[model samples]
Target: MGAHNGVNNMHEVAPMEVSVEAGNFQDAERLDDDGRPRRTGTFWTASAHIITAVIGSGVLSLAWAIAQLGWVAGPAAMLLFAFVTYYTATLLAECYRTGDPETGKRNYTYMDAVRSNLGGAKVVFCGVIQYANLVGVAIGYTIASSISMRAIRRADCFHTNGHADPCKSSSTPYMILFGVVQILFSQIPDFDQIWWLSIVAAVMSFTYSSIGLSLGIAQTISNGGFKGSLTGISIGADVTSTQKIWHSLQAFGDIAFAYSFSNILIEIQDTIKAPPPSEAKVMQKATRLSVATTTIFYMLCGCMGYAAFGDEAPDNLLTGFGFYEPFWLLDIANVAIVVHLVGAYQVFCQPIFAFVERRAVAAWPDSAFISRELRVGPFALSVFRLTWRSAFVCVTTVVAMLLPFFGNVVGFLGAVSFWPLTVYFPVEMYIKQRRVPRGSTKWICLQTLSITCLLVSIAAAAGSIADVIDALKVYRPFSG
Candidate 1:
């Protein structure tokens, strides 16, 4: 396979040289092996991208998920999910190039990797799952950013009007504001162009996560010792047995969502520069570092939050009013969350934009609407791109306003996308690419792993649906 890919890449060499000759001296050096603008992405930039995508608003729900699953199961589920994600990410990274790690045709997206290794109807299936997941993430981030925005206002209200005050404010306007911000940021032309944004977002992720962890620890100390049981929230008058089962299952979805950047792993890999060291190896290292770093934060935040609030932990520890005093600090943390989501929203949505634009260009070929661009000072703006991306943000924002059940929505998305995008596809692609042989020990183990996750995803999705139904019984998201 590697030799075949090497031969194929050899064909591109002549065209690349011809194109360079047609252009300037600088163009040759600025081009990659594939004739695209040179990818300046390095280990640090790749790690930043992973960190920005991995540690998102989803982290805020870890404590709540932990609360449902209890001490033993909560931490265990997080670790298990992290390991599974990292393992599958490594597999997907190996699929980044069809033949040779360096010379093979690059798979620019998750769907491309699927088409290369497990071609057929599966490529279409992968596209549906991957893009749907990205859209859901865009919606989820919109909802999360609004939550933080309202938290800031609510915190100020409480501080000014006294704790007894209702301190209410609707999230609809905030969601709209966030949507507007995203519309502006969505115009960035390429993933590599946003490396600085990713770096800043990564820093903000750590900032808010550290703040949440710190607040949980302080609250735990004040309460004196840990407050949760080995079994987690107990079944009682407030919590029926049926609800307990649903919550526990939904916890699985939350944790799964927290570790899921696999859908974008290939897209991230595409930004990496040509390598003496393969892009797959660099991506593997980034995955390991990101998973380990996030896992530690998850443990501390989840455990401490459960300890602080016991059975009553808020769905979002920071925004759920778990810490009322030090209103200024809460304000800063919430601001950081808002800033982080601003970057995260783009991190998830860029692929969708690229996909649509690519398809339009291929289909239209020379149509002015698809091919023309207007100069805006320093940046060249595409008419179709600006309209399409803006409309996309608006649609997701409207949907987010209608269904802003942050925790449940994320759980549902995680459940729906986890097995297909994160596990099954990667596992299948790996088997086919490596020709692992049917019914062999290794192949059986991989299939078993995939099947187990599928069952888990089914249950988690069912649980999330139940939770959503229950939430709608009193759903008044636009109201404070």
Candidate 2:
């Protein structure tokens, strides 16, 4: 199947062709003439990628969101979001299952899928949005990482000088450190090394949640016991119905905890080496596992965090609960989370690089022209021929550092990019390609559900964008 450009005589080839042109880089180091990764399929490889994608800066934010929404609605919303996630994930898996194997034509990257389902312009639009979103996530993760480190230092009395806050030490030093670590870790030539870091991150995450939850629960119980004394110490009151609604709606960001795993589906597809049919099954299973794991973790963390803070929990729940007595454990957890955030950055970076590489090859089909344009030494030209790859990394780092207060932006972009890629576009492909029985009950029900999901996703995108704007307007200093 091919697409015809509006220009009378010109025809843009099928979007699937780009996948063939882009070439799978999963095993570039061990690439055979077949243009496929050399590795055999394994369950662990798929599982690790999914796990890394699911856990990120979102972990801290989930509980705060739950606090905003009523406790009753929080888990319900997450469950609903999980269902939506599963449906969308299954649709994409179906697309992959039916995709052409020889040309790598079955599974399309986010943009390719969008272009095929919608049109070329949308592909470009979504690509730009996705790239920006990934950059925001990377920077946001870095900022959060730095803030977590600073918190640990202050808790341990490392800031000997009379500074009120550890983070205030010097942005320059932290920025330099963050940049060096990002470059070194990101340049690891194989997934094996990356997986090792992920394992460390997972262990740290478990420890962090366990410690933070225990301390938070203890504090909450203590505060509750002394409720009589704090009777009139109201921080704020719930007055209007609208206020309650807004609060509840805000909590829906907790559901986004699962949305963070959307990229994992793509990552698993890219990393695992299997025939198209097996790859599709693997992607489906991986997506389910990732979301399930994230959901359970968020629910546990949210409940504990809410109990700890009670009505007084700070907006950022995790930070509000100071590190507990096991100072060394807190330090380890903090460091581990920072490392996990780095892995999250890589998750965000891969697609950005892939998209840029495709555009680069398309723009300059001639190797010599591409080489001259990239302007690298001939020896390095083959490996670094894509301008957008480096451009994305530099631009992402600069923007992330400058927009240090980008939590809402990160969440918003995560939702916005996720909606079309995860929900609308995939459904569109399924309808057009599969053409489920037109008048049958199942077909009608499916269409109705798809339409509803599309509307909900649009609302989510709009709300998230507004939230980002509000956050930017009220940027504050790192008081901790």
Candidate 3:
């Protein structure tokens, strides 16, 4: 449409700003400092973007993650992760501008930041990891949204047929349904939170998260008190010792995945308006706000969910029938989940869409198929965007079909990206940009943090991949 605040051209990354190089108006006034568009993002909007990014279906798995870690380590692990995420995120905020906190050249994307600072093969490495993780997240959202969609029907089935019916359902059809929805939303253009659908989705994020927490509390009270063990699921008849180790390691991945929003932190920061207080300071404030808020909710949901079901907590807090009796409530929660995930899928995938479209535009500047926009009602759509975005959705959907287990996929994605995106890149970029003296105390501390997270990421990845392999032994993707 006419610059839907949701799909405003401000998000176009200023690539073609040369045409408007005369200056001014990303729908902005005076062109601000960069001669592109006057930036308008504020601390609050940045906070919303971070919240929407961080708190999604990931929270749904924390109960299971805690079950693996247990009472003693579950909450402790979460707190540790909260600290790491915030610390690294602040370090990253500092790198938004290359040389100075306030005056350095702005790196519009995460790729741009790495390219400007790290250069060399590392830029390629960053791109591969960043985009690959984006693809993995797209697949994870497919699996997750489908699970929520299928849960809706199963919840009804259990209520109508009684819990004894088992009410089994396959996620295949639901995943396809989710893919179809994404294709339509994908065509809407831009993943900025200003979009109407995005705002609704953000509300749904809070809605379901609160619902999960409430359900956990209700279940805990219904059990007369709490229900788990200090050590979590015990290794005896039901679980082998080897299984215990793998599950615990996988739990770290799941938690890491929950906090995996650092990859797009710079993209989110790019939206902030030119400021006297500086984007870094505002972003730091927003990072603290978003992380603190999500962490509190994570703790409430994870600990209470573990307390309610103990070692036997469901892998998905909402869909796993952890609160089976309240059928309507379960439906509501799952619906909220699907809605949130629908938006989350688009939000996360927007970067991939932009990168490809930009490349195509660069390579074939005159091809109508590459450069033309087809009008639909009030809005203008690109033929290329339509084709590629739909194809991407389909690819993700099929991949999700092959590997539908949410926990393992989420963990593996997190493990693969956590060390690189969240910890290492940020730490290295900060060290280089700030030029902490070689082998200095600050340098040593940052290196230690990076190394520790690398180990964690490695263990988590191994555990997730093992579980995936084991799952493949008996599970067939499209079997009825």
Clashing pairs in 1: none
True lDDT of residue 469, candidate 1 = 98
Off by over 4 Å in 2: 1-35, 99-105, 114-119, 158-173, 184-200, 217-247, 273-277, 322-324, 361-391, 437-440, 454-480
lDDT of each: 0.85, 0.56, 0.86
Tens digits of per-residue lDDT, candidate 1, 457-479, equal 99999999999999889987666
Q: Which ten residues in a row have the lowest lDDT in candidate 3?
A: 1-10
What range of 10 consecutive residues in model 2 has the weakest lDDT sum? 1-10
Error of 3 at 459 (Å): 0.2
Candidate 3 residue lDDT tens string, 27-116: 343355675555677788889889888988889889999999889899999999999999999999988999877778999889898988
Candidate 3, TM-score vs. the true structure? 0.93
TM-score of candidate 1 versus the correct structure, residues matched by position: 0.92
Off by over 4 Å in 1: 1-30
List all candidate RMSDs to the true structure.
4.7, 9.1, 4.0
Could you tell me which 10 consecutive residues in candidate 1 have the lowest summed lDDT? 1-10
TM for every model, in the order presented, reads 0.92, 0.74, 0.93
lDDT of 1: 0.85
lDDT of 2 by residue, 15-55 (tens): 12223333543324344224443434444556656665665
Better of 1 and 2 by TM-score: 1
